[model samples]
Target: MKAAQTQLNRYGAGLAVDGAFGDGTDSKIRSFQSSHGLDADGIIGPDTWRALVTGSSGGGGGDSGLLTHAAAAGKFSAAGVTWASSGNCSNRNSTSCTSFDGLRQASADGAVTLRGASGCALTITGGTETGHASGTYSHWNGYKLDFAITSCLSNYVTGTFAYSGTRGDGAALYTAPSGNVYANEGNHWDVTFLN
Candidate 1:
């Protein structure tokens, strides 16, 4: 418990490094969870504990915003989730995996298409895949990305958006998608075009 307290302090909570996980520890945990948008159940779980350690250790991008301008460049260095900017090619690939733009480029002159005609069946933490919108697909251009993703082919990926209005190309909040991935190896990420 003392070691955990020390780690928590290092993460920026600065609570007493008592060896016991008493009220102080519980309080500290709840506070941290609340700030990080966790469940705040006061009982640390894998996700909560990981978030605590991540914030304290600054593993990726702790308490501070998950990937500041990084979202625009397709980066995910933060401990928690973050909504990325709007655009098809703005991000530079935050993860080591890959981006739709790169795949599209390799396709028929940089044009990526889904297997389904319109809506199939998909979900993410918060939204669902209804359809798709395509155009020039410039990087950082927000688009109204409707989803109908599934979890069979693959899950977990980037949702770089390319919107239509004059809305600024940036993230607003951390939203969960109902499904993780869409059809045709595409991931279901709630991408929006801000105006």
Candidate 2:
């Protein structure tokens, strides 16, 4: 808790490094989450911890927010979600594997949020895998995810979320209230969960 408090302080959260997850710390966490474009739940999950320590979302150069202790497969089962791959692959070093290594905690949380909000049976079609576009906020960097498109999920995203213009590739973009970007890629929704 003291480590968290110190990191939060680095981000200008003026809390005493008392090693206690008190109301003050919680409030500061929520505030930091809000400002950093994370879900402000005050729980200090992986995303929040990364943002606090890295001083940014999982963006820019370097390995600040890299998921050294990445969650393994079935990690999302607790959140009532599952994953499938086209090549019958798993989360590993293979190019076909739907690996979650280095995936930002915030992005994973955003997936959980989408599943709960739309009440749709979602399947994660992509993760920190190869064959995705490269960038500072690219999939390999763990700032994005791809979920298979379901009719229910598509309707909820298109009907409920606000239109935010289109991506350079012509995919339609929807902005969630949490500042995440959902790009309609026909077969899937390429989601970019912000810091």
Candidate 2, 1-195: lDDT as tens digits: 999987765444557999988898888787666655578798888888887665555656575444432342323553466787777775545668787777776676577667667778888888888889999888888888888898998999999989999999999999988888899998899989894
By TM-score, how accurate is candidate 1? 0.29
How big is the positional error of residue 6 in model 1, measured in Å on the Cα after superposition? 1.6
Question: Judged by TM-score, which candidate is best?
Answer: 2
Clashing pairs in 2: none
Question: How does residue 97 of candidate 1 score in lDDT?
Answer: 21
Q: What is the clash count for each candidate, in the order shown?
A: 34, 0
Model 2 stretches astray by more than 4 angstroms: 1-72, 91-93
Worst 10 residues of 2 by lDDT: 66-75
Worst 10-residue lDDT window for candidate 1 reads: 103-112
Local accuracy of candidate 1 as per-residue lDDT tens digits, 119-175: 123221221111233444322222233333445312322242222222233322322
Q: What TM-scores do the predictions have? A: 0.29, 0.64
